[model samples]
Target: MTHTAALALASGLGFGLSLIIAIGAQNAFLLRQGLLREHVLPVVAVCSVSDVILIAAGVGGLGSLLDAAPWLVDVMRIGGAVFLLVYAALAARRALRPSAMAAEEARSGTSLWPVVTTAMALTWLNPHVYLDTLVLLGSVAATHGDDRWWFGAGAMTGSIVWFTALGYGARLLRPVFARPVAWRVLDALIAVVMVAIAATLLHGL
Candidate 1:
């Protein structure tokens, strides 16, 4: 590979990982799923594949298309905020109810379909996904000139690696999460993060 291509790939990997490593709605949900060991593979697949598609679209100039239609962002903002708020309420309820604080009890009742749906919603519904993957990453990829595809490839690789690591690696924490109090604390924190993100989205609109 040419130096430019290598540089672009490295840059893309760094930027992509940086954006994803933060504690956001999607990451929080993924972490929770990972901790519960419920539908981890499918959830990780959805998030990684969604990132691949979005990064490809951005590299193909879909960011430009989105820029032309500001209303699309507005719609996403509203939808994402509503979804986040609902999730926040659910988390808060779980946190407050001592009976629901056990991870095993919670896992027994959750179906695969709801988890899959929530994974998709958390990934695609958020407007920040578009801004980060489409606009920010796309703009950076453009700097690579003809090697933009390589940059995107790097970003996609980062996404896959990060999601895989996060989902599977969370099992290592299972012992810590075995306690009811740990689950309660986790749910409470998730609630705070979700509500904060929802508020940010609503304020943006």
Candidate 2:
């Protein structure tokens, strides 16, 4: 690889990871799913694949299409806010009823379909994903000229690696989350984060 391409790749990896590592609605949901050991593979697959598609679209200059239609973002923002509010309500309910937070009880109740659907919603419904992957990453990738694809490949690598680590590594926290109180605290925090993101989305709209 040319030095310039290598630099672009490295820059993409760093920038992508930095954006994704933030604690947001998607990450919070993924962390919860990881802790529950529920549909982890599916959840990770959906998120990673979604990121790749979005990144590809961005790198391919689909951001221009979005730019031409500003109303699309507004629609997504409103829809995302509603979805987040509903999720926050569910989390708050779980936090209030500690009995529901029991590890074993939480594990067997949810079907794979719902978990997968929720993962997809948490991912695709969020307007910020487009802003980050499409607008921000796309704009940066543009700086690489012909090496933009390589930059995208690097960014895609970051997403896959991060999600795999987050989903699998969450098992290490199993011992800690074994306590019902831990689940309660985690759900409460998730609730707060979800609500805050929803509020931010609404405010933006």
Top-lDDT structure, candidate number: 1
lDDT of each: 0.90, 0.89
- Model 2 lDDT tens row, 102-195: 5535564557888888889999999999999899899999989999998998899999999989988888999998787888888899999999
Prediction RMSDs, each to the true structure: 1.6, 1.7
lDDT of 1 by residue, 1-205 (tens): 9998999898888888988999999999999889878889999999999999999998888899778999999999999999999999888888999765555356744678888898999989999999998999999899889999999999999999999999999999999987878988998999999999988988987
Residue 111 of model 1: what lDDT?
77
Off by over 4 Å in 2: 102-110
Candidate 2 — worst ten consecutive residues by lDDT sum? 100-109
